[model samples]
Target chain A: MIDTVAGLAADPSGSTAQDVVLRAENVHVEYDGERPTRAVRGVSFELRRGEVLGIAGESGCGKSTLAYAVTRMMKPPAQLTGGSVVFRDREGRETDLLALEGEELRAFRWNRLSMVFQSAMNALNPVTTVGRQFDDIYGAHRPEMTKSERAERTKALLEMVGIDAGRADGYPHELSGGMRQRVVIAMALALEPDVVIMDEPTTALDVVVQREILDEIERLREELGFSVIFITHDLGLLLEISDRLAVMYAGEIVEYAPAERLTDARHPYTQGLLRSFPDLVGERRELRGIPGSPPDLRGEVVGCAFADRCEYAFEPCRAVTPHLLDIAREGAAGWRAACHLNDPEHRSSVSDAEGPQS
Target chain B: MTALEVRDLVVEYAQSRGKPFRAVEKLSFTLEAGRTLALVGESGSGKSSVLKALSRLVTPAGGQILLGGRDKVPAKEYRRAVQMVFQDPFASLNPSHSVDHHLRRPLLATGRARRGTEADTAVAELLRQVNLTPAADVARKRPHELSGGQRQRVAIARALAPAPDVLLADEPVSMLDVSIRLEILNLLDDLKRQRDLALLYVTHDLATARHFSSDIMVMYRGQVVERGPSDEVILNPKHPYTQLLAAAAPRTGATRAEVRAARQVRAAARSARDAERRETVVGDGCRFRPRCPFAMDVCATRPPEAALGGGHRVLCWLQSEGKAAA
Candidate 1:
C-alpha cells in the first residue's frame, strides 16, 4: 500500500505533494496491565523536514509514549488507543505507522525513522567490538551490501561524526560515556533516517558530556537534514536545542510555540517551569520550585492538572479542564495555551487560590 | 581562622598492574567557617577528588587536610564535623531501609542522638529543619515511596544528623532534574548560613556554583586554574578554561538552534583534541599551554607562581606577568 502511494505521489501530475514529513493526529496511548495507565491523550503534531521539535515535560507526561507511538515501537500492554501517525516517505507516500505489520514496520525502523534512548549505552553488545556493532546495524538493515563495502561506509560515517575510525575496534566498555553516546548517534545516522527521536540521551552524563552529545546530535541533524523529536525534562537544555517547544502537562500538550514564547510563557504551568528552571546566566535569585509534586497519574485528574500547585490558578481552572484556546491579548501569534484565565467567559468563575484543589 | 585548609593535595590510585595515576595534584585552598567555597571543574578535573580527600574516603599522597586550623584530623572527627551529601539522593538511601532507619543510623553511629523515642524525636526535628513536614509520614516510608525532591530532603536531614560543622556537597543537585535542583541548592545555602558552617561545593556547573558559593576555585587537570570570589570568577573569568566553561552554559535568551550550532563546532574541536591525547608537561611554565588560546613561548619553562589576594588566588602565568609589568 505504501509502495503504491509513494509511486502515485511521486508522479508529477499527482495532486498529493505535501512538505510535511510526519503528522500524528489525535494520538492516544495506553499501557497494558490488570490496571493499565493512559500514557498519552489526544497528542498531535507535525514534523517538517529539517525541523527539530522538542517535547518537554516531567516524568510520565507521555512524551516518551508519543515517541514510541510515532515510531510504532509500542510493546505489549502499551497499545495505541486512537489516532494515526502518518509518515510521508521519500517518494511522498503517506502511510499510517500503526497500521503497518511485521516486515513493513521493521523496514522503516532505522531507514526512515530512528530513535536514540536514555540507556543507549546498555543497547550496545559488550562482547562485540564497535566496528562489529556498526556492521551488524548496517548489515541487518541492508543485507545487499558486502562486508568490505559496509566497513568502508561505517568508517566514513564514524569520520563524519568526528569519531576516530581507529576506535571502531574498541569494545563498549572501553569507550567513555561521551564516546558511547556518539557511537549510538552514529548508528542512528547510519541509515540517514529523515526523522530521529531521542529520549533523554544525555540525562546520565555530566553537564560537559551532555553539552558535547547534544552538540553532536545538532550537528548530525544539520548535516543529514533530518527532523528531530528530542525528549527531556531539562527545560534549559530543551530551550537551548529545540526550534519549537511543546510543554506537556499530564498527558496533554498545554502549550506549543516558538522557543522564545516558552522563555516567557502565558500559560501558568509554563510560567512555573520558566521560574523553576535555574538560569546558568543571570543573578542568582532564590529558586522557588513548584510547591507540590505532579498529580498522581495512577488515577484521573479533574480540571487543570497543575491547579493544586499553581500560584495563579482560579475557580474556572478547578471546575473545568481548559482546552487549547488562542488569546489575542498576548503578543504570541499562533501561540496557544490551555487555561481558563485566557477565556473571557470562564474568568467569572475563577477567583484566586480558592478556585480548585484535588 | 580558616575552617579547613588543604595544602599541596595529591590523590593517586595504585593499581596492581599500572603506574599510579595522580587524579588531583598540588591542589590547595582555604575556606572560612561561615563562607562557602565552590570547586568548579568538568568531569575528571579533580573537584570530586578534592572532596574525597576532605572526607577521608580517599587518602591524599602529599597534602595536609586541616580542619579548624589543625592538620591531619582523624576520620571520626571529620565525620562528626564534615558530612557529605552525595549526588543521587535515591542511590544514597538504601531501598530496604525506611527513612527513620536512614536518619537514625547516622545519628546513633556518630553518638549525636541515642536510640529509642528520643532518637525518633531528634530525627523528626532534623527532618523539620530540612522542611520535610509531617515528618512522621515520611519516616515510615522507604526511599522508593518518596519523590526525588523528598528523598533528597531525607538525605540532607541524614547528613545533618551528625551535626556537622563543615558540609561537603559533591554535585548534590546534578543527578536531580532541573525543576527540583534549585530547592536543594537553596536548602544547602540556607543551612550553611544559619549554621555558620563551611561549605565545600564540588561541581562542574558554574551557574549553580555562582548561586551557592561565595568563593570559587576553577580547576582543570587537577590544578587550580583560577580562584576568586564566585561573582568575580564567573562574571569576569581570566583563565581560558573558565571562560570556555562560562561560554558553554546554555543561556535562556539564546535560541536552541543557535546554541546547537555553536556546540557542534565545539564538539568537533574537542573530538580532534581527544584523538591526539596531547600531554601537558608537569614542570612546564603553563600546563594549559597546549589547549590555551593564548600560549606564549615563555610557558615552556618554569611553572606559574600563585597570585594571592583578598579571597582570590590564580596560578596562571598571564596574571603573574601582568602583575610584574604593573
Candidate 2:
C-alpha cells in the first residue's frame, strides 16, 4: 500500500530541468536455457549526468546483468527480455540504446559508452602488446586517426592512468595485475565516452592497488565530466566512491538513496547486508549472516523476494510485491526503499523500534 | 602449550638460472592452542608459502617447525595434528567424489573412525559442526551440487574430520559472498573455542583479519614487517606497509577527504627508486626501505626488530630509533 505517485513527485534529486544521462524503464533480463532464470526483474532507474551511481548486491542479485542490459552488452543465454534504455546527450537528444544494431551499435560503443569488465586484467590480449590493444580500439572507433596519432593517444592514455608510457611496448603478462587493470581503464577512457559501466573493476586487486585505481577513476571522472555506473558486491567501496547508491536484492533494487544517507537504510535486506561485513574503524561487533540463501530465480516469485529472510516480513510481504517508493526521512532527501514496513499503513502493525526513524 | 612453532622458516623455489627465488624468508611465528593468528599480506607476499611449509605440502629449504616443543613428531601424528583448508574450495574438493567420501577419508586415514557405521557417524558429526544441516542430504551430494559457502563448509568439515590440533586456513572466505563469509568465519571461531584448536587464518584483507583473529602478522616480500595484537596492528600500525594497507582498505563511514588523503600518501610513498631497487637489492637491506616514507641511511642495512611493548614488534629503523616518524 505504498503511495507511488506522491513518492515519484517528491524526488528532490530528480527535476524537469536537471539532466539525466541514462534512463532504464521497467528493465527485465533473463538467462534463457532449459531452466530460464529471471536475473533482473522490473528494475528502473535514472543515472544523473556526471555522477557515480553505484549498484551493490550479492553475486546472483543481477547487478551485473542490469549493467549489461543498460549498455546493450547482453549476449546469448543472457537476453534483455523487456526494457527500453534511453541514452540522452548533452543537447537533450534521446536515443533508444536497445534499438541500435550492428554498425550503429559498434559506433555507439566506445564513442558514447564504454565498459570495464570484472577481472579486466585478464581481458587484455596476452599475445598482443598494450599499445596494440589501444590501437585496436582506436582502429575500430577512430579509423580516421593516423598511426602515429594513435600511438601518441595510446601513450597519453597510459600516462593518464599513472603507468609509464614506454611500457606500452610490453605484453600484458609483463605488467603487474594492478598495471594490467589500469591499462584496461585507460583503454575504456581512450574514446572519452560520456558513460562508463565498471563491473567490479577492483575486485581482483589488492586493497592498496584498489585504492590507487579508484582514486585515478575519481580524478578522471572529475576532469572528463562523465557519468559512471559502478557495480560491485562491496558496499563499503560503493559508499566511498558513489554519490548515489542502489542496493539490489533478488533481482530488484530494494533500496536507493544518496551514499551518505544509506547509513539509515529503511530496507531490512540493506540493513542485513550492511551488518554482514565488519567495519574497519568501528566498534567490533559479531557479524550477523543473513539466515537463508538468495531465492532461486528459476521459480516464480509470488511476493517480496526477500520475504523469507527478512526479520520484519509481515503478511503483506508474503502476499504482495513491494514497489520502490520514496520514504520520507530526515537527512535522506531522495531515499527510497521497496519494503512494506516503509509504507504508512504497514508501519502501525510493526513495532516502532523495527520501523525506520524519520 | 604451543601446538606448532615455526622458527626462521625459509622456503625457496628453484629458478632456471642464478639463485633460487626465496618465496618465504626467515618467517617465524608460534601458534598456541585456543588462539587464532592471522597472516595478512598481498599476493606474492609469501603468506601461502608459509601455510604450505607448515602443512608439509612444500618442503622448507631452511629452518624448523617444532611440534609441542619437540624438533620432530611422528609422521602419522603430525598428519593428524596439522591439517590445511585450502583457498579454493571448488578445486580442493574432488568433483566426482561425494561429500561422504571426502569427509570419511580423513577420519579413516587418521584412525579416528573405523569402517561402516563409525565413519558415517563421524561424517555426520563433522557436517553438523560446520553448520551444514540435514547432514544426510548434504553428505550424499557432490561438490558441484553445493553452493560456494556450503562447499567451503564441507572443506572445513573434511579438515576437522581428523580432529587436528592446528588448522591452517588459507583465504577460506575470500571466494564466498559477503553474507555467507561471516557464517564460515563464525563457524571457524566457534570450532576454535570449542575444540581449543590453534588456527592460522591467512588473508590479504586486513578488516576481516582484525575481526576474526587475536594476533595479526603483516608480511611483505617474504618477510615479517609487523606483528602484534590484532587491535594494536590494525589501529596503531607501526610499519609503513601496514599503515598503507590500513589506509587503502575501504571502511564503512570513511570520508572522501580521508580516502583522498590516503591516496596522496600512497602516491608519495611509491618512489621510482624503489621499483629499480627491488630488482638489484637482495638480502643486504630492509625489504621495505625503498618504499618507506620514513626510510633513512640506516634503513639500507637490515633493521633489528623493535619491541613496541605489549607483545607488539615492528621491523623498521625509525621504530628502533624511537623516532615514531611514520
Candidate 3:
C-alpha cells in the first residue's frame, strides 16, 4: 500500500536517489501479554544519508519503541510483529535489519547503526572507568586491535566531545551528567557507524548543557557524515535540528513533512501540538493544550486516534481511517498527512461547515 | 496585596566531609497576590531550594520569611497559608490511596473539614476546582489509574485543599507530556485569577516561565542575575546569562538557519570565557563571571544592583556604571 507513497522525489535540499540510508516500511510492534498493546502500528519512513530525521511525539506514543525496534533492541514481551527495516551501506549494499539473527545481527549493530539511549546517566557503567567502557565496545567489535590502539581511540573520542582525555580514567560517578552523556555518545561513535539513533539524549541535562551537547552532536554529524534519527517529545527542538520530521500520535505517523513546513501543518493534531508549546521569542498567545489523553493502545483503534481531542474531527474521522497521502503545498511539495481534512473531495464539504480550529 | 516576602534568604546543605554548602544565597523576592513570580534556572541552580524553603522542607540558614508584611506568624497558620505542588506527580501522589483520600488528608489536617460528610464535600470541590470533571468518578480512582496530566491535577487539587493564599509549584509540569503541560499551566493561571492566589513557579525552562508568570527572575549558581517584568526581561535581557537562556530555548517558528545562528552565538560566547569547575565558591564577586562573555576587571569585585526602570533590575558592573553615568 505504501508503494504509492514510496519513491517520492528527493527533498529540494539536493538529496539524490542514492542518499537514502534507512527505510522502515509498514512496521508493527506489539507488547505481548494478557491484553497486548500495539505500540507501533504500520509506521513507515525513510532516512537519507547525512540527514537529520526527527520523530516527535508524546510519551507512550510508541516513538521510542519504534526507535528500539529499528535498532533491533526490543526485548522480550515487546516483539516486532511485521514489516521490514532496510539499511543501505556506503557501498550500496542493502540489508534487512529485522531478518538478521545471532552473530550477523551483532555484526550489523554498532558497525552500521548505533543508538544513544535516554537518560545518559544510566547508560554508562558506574563500576568501571570511562576508558574501560570505551575499551569494552572496541574489544567486542575489534577483538584483534591492540590495547594501545583502543586507548588511543578512546582518548581521541573523548577529545572530540570536548572532554579531557585524562578524565577517561575516572569512574562515571566522578563526571557530571553532561560529561557522562558525552561519554555515551563517544561509545556510540566508537565503531564509526553510518547512522546514529539518539533517544532523548539530553532530556536529563539542564538547558545550557543540553544546548552544548546538541551543538557537539551537530558538529560531529557534519564532520563524521552520519545520518541521525533523533527522537524526542520536544517539537521545538525537532524543528530546530531536523531536516525532515515525522509527527507520531498514538502509534501512527500523522504527519510527515519538511521541518520548515511544520509551522503551516495540514494535520489538525500537528497544528495542535505546534500551538501547545510556549514560544520563547514571539508574541505571547494563550497556549491551548490538546485536551484529553491519548487513546489506549490496548484496544484496536477504528478511526482517527486523535478524534476525541481534535476539535476539527469530522464524520469520516469517526467512521473511516485516513491513509497517509501526499498533500502538495507551495514550498512544501511531497508533504503527507493522514487526515481527511487534506482530502480534496472531503475538504470541499467539511470546509463549509467548519473553519480551521487552530 | 503582598502574599509572601522572602528577604535575604539563605539555604545551606551539609557535606559529608566539608563545610556546609550554600545552595541559595541572600535571595530576596516579593510575591503579590493574584500574580506569579517565576524563578528560572538550570538544575543545581537553587530554584528548587527557594521552593523548598518556602514549604519548610529545608530550614533557612538565615533571613526572614514574612507573611503579609508581618515578620512572625503562627506555625499552623503559616503552613495553612502556603502549600506546595511537587514536580513528579507519580511520586508525589500515594499510589495506594484514592484521590479522595489524598485531598481529604490536607483538608482534615488544616481544619477545613470536621466529619466524613464535610470532608467528602471538600474533596469533591477541590477536584472540581482543578477541572477534574465528574469529581465523584475521579475521586474513587487511585493515582496509578490516572494519567500523568490527571495525576498532576489531583496533586494541584490536594495543594488547594488547604485553602492556601500562596502556592509553590516546583516544576509542576516538567515531567508531564508536551500536550498536557499547557493545560496544567492554564489551570494554574485560572486558579490564580479566581482565588487571587500568589504563585511561585520554579522551573528550568524559561519559555514556560514567560508564558505563565508576570514577573521573572533569572538565577545563576545561587544568586539572582536579572529580574523584571516577564515581557521586558525576556524581550530585552540585560544579563548575558538571560540572553544565553533565551537563545538556547528552541522556538517553534525558528528556522534551521536561525537556530544554527543562535547556536553559533552561544558557542562563541561559551568559548570566550573559561567556565569554572569548582562546586563551591566563597567569594563576594559575581559567581557567573567565570563564564560571562562581558566579564571585566570590575566583575572581580561585588557588583551593585542597577535599577533599569519598570521594576527591572540587573546585578552587573557594566549596567550599574551605565545607569550611574546616565
Best by lDDT: 3
lDDT of 1 by residue, B14-131 (tens): 9788678788988878877778888888777888888888888888889888888888777688779888899889799999999999999989999987789889899999989899
List DockQ, one per candidate, in order: 0.55, 0.68, 0.75
The iRMS of model 2 comes to 1.7
Collision pairs in model 2: none
TM-score of 2: 0.96
Better of 1 and 2 by DockQ: 2
List TM-scores for all candidates, in order. Answer: 0.91, 0.96, 0.97
The CA lDDT at A325 in model 2 is 74
| A227-306 per-residue lDDT for model 2 (tens digits) | 99999999989988998899999899989988876877788888888888788767888777777899999999988999
Score each candidate by Cα lDDT. 0.79, 0.87, 0.88
Candidate 3 clashing pairs, residues 3+ apart or interchain: none
Tens-digit lDDT track of model 3 for B201-310? 99888888998999999998889989999999999999878987887787778788888887787777666655325444446887877767777776768888989999
lDDT tens digits, residue span B160-244, model 2: 9989999999999888898888888999999999999999999998988999999999999899999999999999998888998
Q: Where does model 1 exceed 4 Å of error?
A: A1-17, A327-333, A348-358, B255-285, B302-310, B322-326
The order by descending DockQ is 3, 2, 1
RMSD of each: 5.0, 2.2, 2.1
- Winner on DockQ between 1 and 3 is 3
